[model samples]
Target: MRNVVLAHALARDLNVSAAVIAAFADAPNFHTAHRVRSSGSELLPGPGKPLITPLSYQSIIAMTQSLSRQASDWGDLAAWVNRKIEHVLLKPRHKLRNHI
Candidate 1:
């Protein structure tokens, strides 16, 4: 949705390919900081032909939930929460990976 909205806005402002806009729309998960930082990419213009930025969809939800609760807080259910949250957070990505 973020990607879609950005692509729509960029397409409205810039006369570029829909695919290019679509690609930019998915930068968080499709790219890495190393790739974006190693050098400028398709996001740059003028002589940069293959303007591509990688997306790396960092997961904050699980991390936040984990940090919100501590070992003492979990008491006897730490293991259960760990397994359950891990599964919930990873399920979509796992499916995506499998599908891909």
Candidate 2:
């Protein structure tokens, strides 16, 4: 969802073709829904306590590599994505540190 929004922004800013932006926004078939499990014990956990499982470190690495490859295939879109990622990651921390 967020990726779609970013793709639109990139399309407008970079003058990317709509077809390419659509391709970039499409998720790879490997992507799947997060699994849900009981919050505590498997058998004795309280009701209404489902927890969404987080992606493993290896999964994160694989997804990052896949995205990198996809971005690279898009040429200039790759640079735009990297800049957006850096800005999103660093801007908040810098603002927080300044406030502190």
Candidate 3:
């Protein structure tokens, strides 16, 4: 496994025991383990954390597909402009409300 190879290389390079190298590799996990403090606050995830949102991912894919299918003609451009104007005008109140 990659961990074993890395531990071996680190052990050789740093002139430390394999157990020490393995401990070093696991230091982050050890520090970040989920345990409540006396003050009742939890530590937030740091670097190398991945979060997934399925609906957001699907919405982006759909938007890309829809935009790619729009025609390059002048009429299509005008319609697109009108739609943008309507969205900007009609949705300003809702957008500002959401932000506030």
Better of 1 and 2 by TM-score: 2
Which candidate leads the pack in TM-score? 2
Tens digit per residue, CA lDDT, model 2, 1-100: 4654565577669976322111211112212212212222122113543222244333444466677856444555545555544554455654633322
Clashing pairs in 2: none
After superposition, which runs of candidate 3 have C-alpha atoms over 4 Å from their true positions? 1-72, 94-100
- Which TM-score value belongs to model 1? 0.21
Two-way lDDT contest, 1 vs 3, winner: 1
lDDT by residue (1-100, candidate 3, tens digit) is 4755675578679976453111111111222111211222222222532121112222333455567744345445445545544554465565733422
TM-score of each: 0.21, 0.23, 0.21
Task: Estimate, for each residue in 1-100, the C-alpha lDDT of model 1 and write its tens digit.
Answer: 4664576578658977433421222222323333454654445433544334443222223334467755454443445544544554456665644422
Q: For model 3, what is the C-alpha lDDT against the true structure?
A: 0.37
